[model samples]
Target: MKRFIGFIKKEFYHIFRDKRSLFILFGMPIVQVMLFGFAITNEINNVDIAILDHSKDANTKQIIDKISASKYFSIKDFLDNERDIETAFKKGEIKAVLNFEKDFSKKLMTENQATVQILTDATDPNTANTISNYTSSILSSYQELLNKDISIPYQIGVQTRMFYNPELKSVFMFVPGVMTIILMLVSAMMTSISITREKELGTMEILLVSPLKPFQVIVGKVVPYILLSVINAIVIILLSIFVFSMPVEGNLFLLGAETILFIMNALSLGILISTVSASQQTAMMVSLMGLMLPVILLSGFIFPISSMPFPLQVISNIIPARWFIIILKGIMLKGVGLVYLWKETLILVGMTLFFIALSVKKYKIRLE
Candidate 1:
């Protein structure tokens, strides 16, 4: 019984000494809880919306002031004409637009009715619908206020126009997000163990003794994953198209190119993780803990980035899945071409090169 107690004490000592174990036990849970708490919110804050006021009257100004005063939306643009609305949406910063019809005050005062169109970018249908509902609620409250003691009820008609996804189908958003997650899984999680597996099996030393260059070694290790990832990407796209009835409106070649770029970026990151990790389990833990959460939470997969806190929004720029999701959505839903997507494409390319260079540098150090 004494020896068993000693053994138990020894186990505790070992666990306490191992920082990684301690982190896994305590740190990870706290971090995950905090991340989920902050990032999983459905309520939007400081969402950028545009205003197109044709009347510019007292009622229009009051309604605009009420909307702008709210915490949910920030007025990003004051449009001159309807043509600029499409241009604003294409720029991607403007998520919603409030277009007040002509003679808003006149109509509301004389006819007891007025119309305001709520145009929303519905790439993520949930957000668009939520924005429309919130705006309508605000208008409804205003109508009630106007008719509080009056004999005739003042009516505010809200017309919602959902751009990119008129039907507000949930699948339209999920397909691109699922595609990003799957590709990241296939490319990063699998290859993250490649070098660690070699190190575990005692073949890493043999590879060091071999004449093959680090670049060749890394490339050789990741080639199969790259191919498999490409295949996986194609399958997801096909499934999205045939099964989910998702549209691929942009150039097929451009989409394929972007997909390949993202795959390479993920694979390179895996190689980097494998290079840094001492064991396959460590590699996987790092991959899962480090990559998965950021991909799911920070990448705008389920939540709108515009709604997240400023710091999380800034941090999300480093998440590869975010850019890839944007590219996929642009190509599939918006039918945008490289002209509009050049920035995201360049970012992925830069990330791929950065990871590969870092992994290669680490891999070369193994020889010395």
Candidate 2:
């Protein structure tokens, strides 16, 4: 027990003595939370739009007034002709063009129906879809106001319920994804580099030649990283809960267990990397280029896997972070238990075993 305590103390000394590691241990979670919460968001406001109101009547004017009053869009240009719409869009002056049919008021009163065409640049499909929805909602509200003055025989309304995110805030999705990425970066990349550093410095040989076994040396090197990763996870969860107002609806114990499982998987990957790499630089480069990039790009962190190219989509299936993120969202946002997330949890366990086996094989080959 005393020896273990001494070992833990030594680990703390090593962590505190290295300024870079110390900074990374404490700084990364805060920076990641701020970046994901404020910067990366799907909710857009003040998008510029162009109006081409051909009707120039009371109905068109009223609709335009309503649109302008809303905060979602800012009317930047008023097009005189159809050609102006194309020119303005080409010049990137506006994201959408609102076109009102000629004699809109006359048609609505006499024909009891009129059509308004909303033309949006589909270059960014998500933004385009959001703008269309906002415009439609404004139109619907205006139609509802008009309907209140008259009596209708039958009325049908569709009710919508957003399951996980009632407010549809993008941060709800981003929080868990960002947390997973930070854990991967810190636990896997840092451990790999630190272990390889001892090998590069000839200290690993000294430890191996001493009374300590190969497994003990590796365990000693990784123990600090595991503890640090747990702290980092706690920090990230706290930030998501308090700072971002994100909910953790599942059992806290389950969340902690899954986090530890992912950390173990990441640490095993680090051990595998350390076995393969001879120098700290090689380990860092491999961790960043080989693991980090795939985890970020292919793990459905920012881009949806369903939307990726066929080959990339297939490749994404193997990224551990992808499954972990799905598990996290299920537990954190949807309030699901282990029954729903067992498949993902099992995949992470399988990956950890694979990494451990590979590292052991490689380490044995090195000894031979």
Candidate 3:
């Protein structure tokens, strides 16, 4: 019994001594709990919306006040004309716009009825549906309050029009997100393991002693993976178009160019991973486990970033997938060109360059 107890004590000491093991034991659970608890909510919080109140009546003012008071929404801006709604949506500033019909109070007094139009961007159908439902509930409550003191029942009709995706198809949202995830994980995983495999086989030394420069070595290692990842992207886009019957509303040539840039970004990230890791297993684990959650959650793939906490929203900005998904939706659904998407495109370009330069620096450090 004493011998067995000593052995157990020694194993515990060994586990406590290893930093990686300690992180796996304690850090992983805390991170997973925090992320899952915070990032997985279905309810919308502080969703940005616009107001276009043509009525400017007492009733319309009261409804606007009620909506602004709700925790689920934030009034981003007030549109002065009908033409500004599209501009708001294309700029990605607001999710929905509330248009109060003219003579709202007059209609309510004479006819006991009025209409409000809810124009929502349905690129993300779940959020659009949620916003519409929540807005309608608030309107219903106001209607009930008005009826409580009067003999006549009042009705506020809500007419919802989903923009970008009129049908609110789930596939339209998923395709861009899935394509980003697959290209990112696959490219990173494959390239990450490649150099690590070489290191484990003892061929990394031979390549290091060869005439190739550090950047050249890194580029040569990643070029093939970039090509493969691009091919994978092409296949996915084709499937999204043909199999899912998804519409490509923007320029196909531009889409192709952006896809290549994203693939290169993913590949460079993989090279960075392999350069830092000592083994294939380590590289593989870092590529898959370290990246999976952030890509899915923080990239605005499943949930709205604006709905998350302010910190998470800020952290999401650094994620390449977030920018790429924006580009995809802009081109595929909104039909916006580079003129409008320049910021997101520039972001991807900067990230790709940063990853490649950092990987080269890490590679040169290793050569020392």
Candidate 4:
């Protein structure tokens, strides 16, 4: 027990002595939270739009005023010709173009309806769709105001219920993803680098020459990381719950268990990387380039798997973080239990086993 305490003390010393590790350990969580919370968001606001109003009429003017007044869009430019629309878009000044047809008010009075062409830059499909929706909503509201005295024969109303996020807060979506990324960074990247550091410093050889078995040394190194990762996970969860007011619908015990499992899986991957990499830099690069990229891109954190290219979709199936993220969303947001997340749990377990097996094999080769 005294020896174990001494080992843990040494581990803490190593952690605190290294400024880079300390910065990553403490600063990364806050940075990730801030980046996800403020920088990366799906919600659209203050979109710049250009209007080409050939029709100098009250109705056209009214529509333009309504659009400009609404919070979603800001009129960036008033163009005279269609050619300027393309030029403005090329210059990246406007996201959308609202073209009012000639004699818009006269046509509306004579024909009861008028044509207004909305030409949008579809390069960013999401922004384009949002701009279109906002424009349509503003026009509809204006029409409703104009027809306040008249009553329609039939009216259809859409009651939209955003199931998981009623407020559509980006924090709810990002908390899980940020947690996953931090866990991956701490457990996988840090462990891999730390383990390889021992090898590079020639301490691993002395440890191997001592009474400590290869497995024991590896376990001792990893156990502390696992504990630190669990603590970090708790810190992040508490921040999300108290600060962000995020809900944890499922059992907290189960969430903790699954988080430990993910950390173990990540730690196993780190061990495998350390076994293959001779230097800490190589391990860090491999963990970031190989593991982090996939976890962020293909894990359905930032992009939907269903919308990805078929090959990339298939490739995403093998990424352990993908399964972990699904389980997280299910338990945290959807309020699902072991029954729904069992398949993902099994996949994570399988991955952990595979990583362990590969590491053990490589370790034996080095020994022989």
Candidate 5:
């Protein structure tokens, strides 16, 4: 019993002595708990939506006030024409649009019922579905409130129109996310590991001493992975279009250009990771474990960003995958082009340049 106790104590000491292992043991759990707790949530909040009030009366205003007052949605703009709903959705300004029938108050008072059209941008099926459900709930609550006062037989007929993904196919949502994850895993993780492998094998020093510039060496190492990532992206797109019958509404050339830009961004991130990690094992762990979760969770791939707490939503702004997913949804689902997606494209470009610059500085410091 004494020998066993001593052996256990020694193992504990060994574990405590290893900082990396200790961090992985204790710190990783805390980090993961915080991420899953804070970042991963199903509760929708502050969803950007628009309103088309054909009947701008007391009842319609009351419904609008109730919707705006709810934590689930934020009214962005009061649209004029029914025609503007599609334009607003394409511009990525709103997730859902609420349209009230003309003479809403009169019908509710005399006919005892009124119609409310809930049009959602269903590129993100989960969010769209949630928004529809929440809108219905709110309208139901409003009806209850009205009944409490006068026991009116008024009904709110909700006509939900899920645009882009009318059938709410899960494949429509997953393909873009799968492409983002695969490209990230392949381009960033593989490039980092490949670069660190050269360093681990002592070949990096030889490359440094060679006539090839460090940037040239880094570019040469990453070019293969870039090509692979591009090929993988093309395959994912083809599969989405052919297998899933997913529509590509936007310009194909623009999508290809954006894919190349994102690949370059991910490659820069990999190069930065390689500069920080001394060995291939470290690079692999950092890329696979560190980068993977954020790409999956915080990027709004699985969880709706609006549904997450404010802090997580703010943090998600830094994730490259988040922007890419938005771009993908915009182009693939909304048929939006550069005019609608230029902001996200510029963000990716900025991030790529920042990573490349940081990596270059780190590489120069290592040489010194």
Candidate 6:
């Protein structure tokens, strides 16, 4: 009984002495819950939009006001010509554009019909589609108001054109998400476990004392995983294309490049995790519990971020997988190049750099 008690005490001391293990045991849950509970959302709000009102009459003004006043849209600018719509979308100033045909009131009253065009940047097909639906609902309400007092029937024809994804395939949405999960699991989880296994076997110290620099050692450990992740990404993409008939509308080279960036980001994250986990078991646990759940729930893979509570929406912005998925959907469905997805690309790049820097700093601290 005395020996068993002493053994338990020694184990507790060892766990407390290892800062990384203690953090994994205690700190990881707090971070995971905050990320999961706060970052997973499915609501959209304050979507930026541009309006082209050829009929600058009272009725047109009323409809525009309704759209602007709604929580779903913020009118950024009123354009003069149709040529500017593409420019605004490319500039990332607006997600949608409203085009009211000329003499809208005249057509509504005399001809008993009016036309309005809703053009959305379909790079993010789901968001673009949602914005269009909101806009249509607003216009429908206005139409009802205009006909409320009259026996004569009138209709507002909303011509909605979803650019990039005309059909809005559900497969278009999931391919990117699947790619993100696969890469995250393959790169981060695998690399962390591989590196930590060496520590568990007491081989890490021998490698640390060898001729290889810390960065070199980390790179060597991650490179094979990176290659495997790339292969996995390719396989997923091929399946999406051939089996699901998903379109690779954007530049294939760009898609490949972005996949590589995402894999690298995952690898850096794995290295950071490995630095904090002392054993293979700890690494696997952290990778699965601490990393996987957040990646799955917070990355906008299974749930729409806008639909979540506001706090969760804000937190979802920090997940690397969320940005990578956006980039993938843009390239795959919308055929958007770097011009459209540069922001997401830069975000992934920044996350990769941040993780690598953190891992380097933590490695230095441990060596000291």
Best by TM-score: 2
Model 2 scores a C-alpha lDDT of 0.87
Per residue, candidate 3 scores C-alpha lDDT tens digits across 217-305 of 66666765566567677767777787667789999999999999998998899999998898989998998887778999999988899
Clashing pairs in 4: none
Off by over 4 Å in 6: 1-152, 160-163, 364-368
Q: Native-vs-model 5 lDDT?
A: 0.81
- How many collisions per candidate? 0, 0, 0, 0, 0, 10
Candidate 1 residues 89-174, lDDT tens each?
99999899999999999998899789999999999897899999889989988877887797755766568799898866666777
lDDT of each: 0.82, 0.87, 0.82, 0.86, 0.81, 0.78
Instruction: Write out the backbone clash pairs for model 3.
Output: none
> Which residue runs does candidate 3 get wrong by more than 4 Å?
1-157, 364-368
Q: Point to the candidate with the largest lDDT.
A: 2
Candidate 1 vs candidate 2: which has greater TM-score? Answer: 2
TM-score, one value per model:
0.60, 0.88, 0.60, 0.85, 0.60, 0.58
C-alpha lDDT (0 to 100) for residue 309 of candidate 1: 100
- What lDDT tens digits, residue by residue, belong to model 5 across residues 22-98? 45433443344334434544557799999999999999999999999998899999999988999999999899999
Arrange candidates, best lDDT first.
Answer: 2, 4, 3, 1, 5, 6
> Which pairs of residues collide in model 2?
none
- RMSD (Cα, Å) of candidate 5? 16.5
Put down candidate 2 lDDT per residue, 242-306, tens digits, no spaces.
Answer: 98899999998999999999998998899888888888899988888888899889999889999
State how far residue 169 of model 2 sits from its true place (Å): 1.7
lDDT per residue as tens, model 6, 281-321: 88888878877787789888888887988988898898899
Can you write out model 4's per-residue Cα lDDT over 5-46, one digit (the tens) per residue? 666677777887999997887788877876887778777778
